[model samples]
Target: MSVTASQVHGAVQTLTQSSDTLFLLLGAIMVFLMHAGFAFLEVGTVRHKNQVNALVKILADFGISALAYFFIGYWVAYGANFFADAQTLSQGNGYELVKFFFLLTFAAAIPAIVSGGIAERARFYPILVATFFTVGLVYPVFEGMIWNGNFGLQAWFESQFGYGFHDFAGSVVVHGVGGWIALVAVLFLGMRKGRIRAGKHTNFAPSNIPFLALGAWILCVGWFGFNVMSAQTLNGISGLVAMNSLMAMVGGIVAALIAGKNDPGFIHNGPLAGLVAICAGSDLMHPIGSLITGAVAGALFVYLFTYLQNKTKIDDVLGVWPLHGVCGAWGGIAAGIFGQTALGGLGGVSFVVQLLGTLVGIGIAVGGALVVYGIINKVSGLRLSEEDEFNGADLAIHKISATSDD
Candidate 1:
């Protein structure tokens, strides 16, 4: 029997959709691994007693994020839902399902980012509650505005600035939002016990530098997926994003090394700062521009992290506000600068538009965080008791230490 042209065309179309779905699935899986990176990073940074809590919070936040996003967040952002039957959902090789999974990884990252800031003393259930509302409501609203174009926000920007906002991969959408929200939570929670003695900052050295290094390495590796897979489809994928990511990572590492004066923690985090800054413009900027962006972001992390810890005595435990909040914002705005033709970039981004988009994200994040964390603080309270705090979250929360001999 001869296959007709229609049959052949249908086969090819199915094959293409299947390939795209697989591509997205792999991307989702890779991003899911970044949660591990987040976990390890926190584990390495927090005191030994709090290490288990750090590990648990990352995993728990991801689980909570998955549920919230699946049931509420996705629909809130995109006006879509999983109320459809599996047969209907599986259409297009289940691309939509895989897309949800991919984006869920990003949504979950918000709580993970916060985990670092509030670690050591936050009540676990309260943080989970915050995660539920955050992923379910706050994050999705802005996410929809930027990615799904739910509101006329992007259109409004274009009307005024000659271009819509240009966050190609959520420097502002994910990292910046997560960072700013983390800041509010950190402020509300206040410094960890013993974090400040007198008016000066007290040093609580990282529990494990090797573990910290490992976490940084994992994040660095997984970020490629975080950046590259952001294209969402095979046809949209670009080598440029990957190259830019690499250059930016390298630039951050080098800059942090110099600015941090060979501090190991700073050295590891340098690459992350660079990657964060380059995400918004990776597709459009020259590699050199990405390198500069990354370098600046890396230096920013070193300076801000130090200043906050020593000068202000704001105990952002892992400096999420600096690493994610500020660097992420810088990256979003930098996209506008580096993505212009005059600066060896592709020239569709408007600086003013990018600036406004970033500000909006930050504003929403601050408001949401204050509301969520504030209410949670007022209602159930957000901190462990002083006894629990002194005992370490391992025994207080998890009933065991990470390295328990028994």
Candidate 2:
């Protein structure tokens, strides 16, 4: 016999709430593990001397992001300002608190991505300073204004397109910030000493493959949370988001293999690039769209990494631009191409809107990151001395070395 209508309703509610809570919690844990990935990946990408420094920076920056988010970052980025007329902060639990927690993790992760680009050659103290500025001040303000509907891009996204913009998982917000920061750091730090000196190529090999591979894998796993949890509610949509994520990873891997690199480092960029590519439209895309996005991102990442490393002379040690920035741009545009209002209303999965939103986000993130880092560079100095860099940041700044003593 069929259940009564009331009974059916009750069962549905219970199932949805329980599943939502479980998935969100699981996603949070997965996202947290991404920090480990960053630690291993960044450390492995740098020289042996800077291994400890790379790990330390990742850990410390996370700490700083947590603190900053708790204090001001949360309020600025995801506070109850946008839907001011529509909602209010109750006693304890509300969207305000929920959004804060969700966005804080993302804001923190952005700076972590940049840590690798400046590895081996940036001062320890400067790392702390940069993290503070990036997480505490820069990222929060930009993200809050745009997506949170508090101050910046909300009206633009809404008025110009007749539909608000949607990131699904912060392609423009988190990755864009990190990419821009990496750009600034590299420009300020300049090329590694021998990389440019006397025109001799001093290949910087990863110190530990385990660390690098582990980091890359962890990042891929954690990305499920990074993309899915952004929904703030889990339903069938969670499955779609997760599916897109997987497809994108496959695409990235294929692209990496096609790029044909002797080094694993080049190949590793594929997964990251794919993740970044699908971020904007994960919830909106068909399975095929996700697959294509990931594939393109993976291939683009390898090519971009090679070009930046050999041709452009910008030493993005962790390949932030290709993985986050370039793929982020792709994600944004893909959102425009694939996004549809039928998929997720008001958010207007429209491709045109997505393209405009992507450009806007890029312009602001790139320009703002450049300015903030430039100012920091002018003040305390962003790069370690040539001697310090050659010796290793861990030894120069932290007084510890990964290498064994004789």
Candidate 3:
């Protein structure tokens, strides 16, 4: 039997759809692996006694976040839900399912980012509650506004300025929101025990450098999927995104190495700071521009992490505010700058629009985090007791340590 043109066309389309679905599925798996990075990063940063709590929290938060996003967050963001029959749900080669899985990884990251800031002292269940509210409501609201164009905010930006706010990926939306929210929770939770005494600061050393390095490496590798896969379809993918991500990562590392004075923690976190900054404009900016953006983000993380921890007395354990929050914001604004035609970029971004969108993201994250965490704090309490603090969160909450001695 001979194949007709119609049959050939149909087969080609099916092949394309299957390929796209597979690509996104791989991306989802890669992003999902970043949670392990989040877990081990927290594990290596906190004291040995609290290591188990850090590990447990990331996994637990991912579980709760999946449910929260499935039931409410996905709907709030895109007005889509899994309420349809299985047949309908599986349409488009189950593209929607894999898409949800991919985006759910991003949604779960909000709580993962917060977990780092509030680690070693936070109550597991209460933080999980906050994560549900944040993933289900707070994050999706802004996500819908920006990515889905739900609220006409992007339209307003385009009308008021030139082009609308452009976050190809989610520098401001994911990292920035998570960071600002984590900052608020950190402030509300107050200093960790013995971190501050007589208005001075005490340093806390990381428990495991190897684990920290491994976590950073995992995140660094996974971030390519995070940034590039945001295109969501094969035709939309670009080598520009890949190159820009690479430039930004090295830029962050180089700057962090210099600014951090060769500190292992800062060096490991440098690539992350750069990648966070580059996510917004990865497709638009030239590699050199991305390098500058990443470099700035790296320096910003180093300086702000130090200032916030020491001078300001904010005990943001993993420096999420600097790495994700501030650097993410910088990434947002940098997109407008480095993405301009004059700056060797693809253009079509307005600096003012970028700033406004970034500010909106910051405001919503801070406000929503305060309300959610604040209520949780007032009602059920957010922190472990001082006794728990002394005994370590692992022993206090989980009844075990990372290692057992007979």
Candidate 4:
């Protein structure tokens, strides 16, 4: 049978829709795998007694964020149709459904970061409360305004600042927000046992290098979907994003090797740093730019983790700030330099405006997290009882012992 003009047009439309759906699905799968990465990473970093607690937190955050995103979180972030003037969202029903899954993944990052902060000793209920607020309110409200085409903060920045800060994916929206929350939670939860002494620090080797390796690998791989899908258009952009991501990870690995003085633990985290760095402009920058960004991010992780560990006595059970906060900041700034329209319009942001917007994002992220964590601490109390902390949260709180008797 001869193909009519109408048939050709219908075929094209079907192909286009199918392509969009495929990309969305790919993004969802990659994001989900990052949870497994977190599980191994967190469990490996903490003591054996607390391993189960950390792992449980990772699982809980992933599950809770999924449900929360499906319910109120997705609507808050992308459901502007809940309000009028959400024209772009209204045009496609699929966009609405995809938005929920996307935001769920994004919102999960904050709770994941916070998990490291409260690890080893916190009561699970307090963490549950914090997760509820972060997914349901903090992340969705701000990021929704950014991507949903609303004439709110992002638009205001673009109008007044001559260039809005462009995080091609979610360096600022996801990783930055997560890091800030982790920082605040760390403050409220206080130091873990043996972390603070008179004037010196002790080395706490990861319980399992294999676990750390696995988590870092998962995060690095998933990042391709996380960063690339943010562009959300069918074309060569996904390839570029993936390429940038890979190069950045390579650069990070090299940087970590050099900075760590050949330590395996430091080298292991390099991939995560690279992934986080590229997250800001995976679709907007060339491979060379990713190389530079990734190296810097990897170096920053080394410095931040070491300094914070010894100086502040902040026992980041999984080094969340180093991987998420520092690298996430690098990714956002890199977008300003490499996001030229020649690339993907990410570098088109003016330096000054991008700086301002970045600061505003940082402020919102850090300040909101501080306030939220403080309140949670006040209401539910952030850490476990002193005796409980010494005994380990896994057994103390959950009754899941680390010993063979279990």
Among these predictions, the greatest lDDT belongs to 3
Compared with the true structure, all predictions reach lDDT values of: 0.92, 0.76, 0.95, 0.77
lDDT per residue (tens digit) for residues 56-125 in model 3? 9999999999999999999999999998899999988999999999999999999999999998898889
RMSD of 3: 0.9
lDDT of candidate 2 over 1-406, digit per residue (tens): 9889999998887777666656555666677788898899987778788888888888888888888777767766655333344345422224344545566678878778888787777877766777877787777776776676766466776777676667778777778667876787778787877676567445667778878888898898888888878776664456888888898888888878778464687677687888988887888887677888888888887887778887877888888877888788888787776565454322355567777777777776667677777787788888888888888788888888887798
Looking at model 3, the pairs that clash are: none
Q: How many backbone collisions does model 4 have?
A: 3
lDDT per residue for candidate 4 within 105-153, as digits (tens), equals 7788788877876678788977887788788777776677666654477
TM-score of each: 0.98, 0.87, 0.99, 0.91
Residue 328, model 2: Cα distance from true site in angstroms: 0.9
Lowest lDDT block of 10, candidate 4: 80-89
lDDT of 1 at 368: 93
Q: What is the C-alpha lDDT profile of model 1 across 210-236, one tens digit per residue?
A: 989998998899898999999988999
- The model with the greater lDDT, 1 or 2, is 1
Supply the global lDDT for candidate 3.
Answer: 0.95
What TM-score does model 2 achieve against the real structure? Answer: 0.87
RMSD of model 2, in Å? 4.6
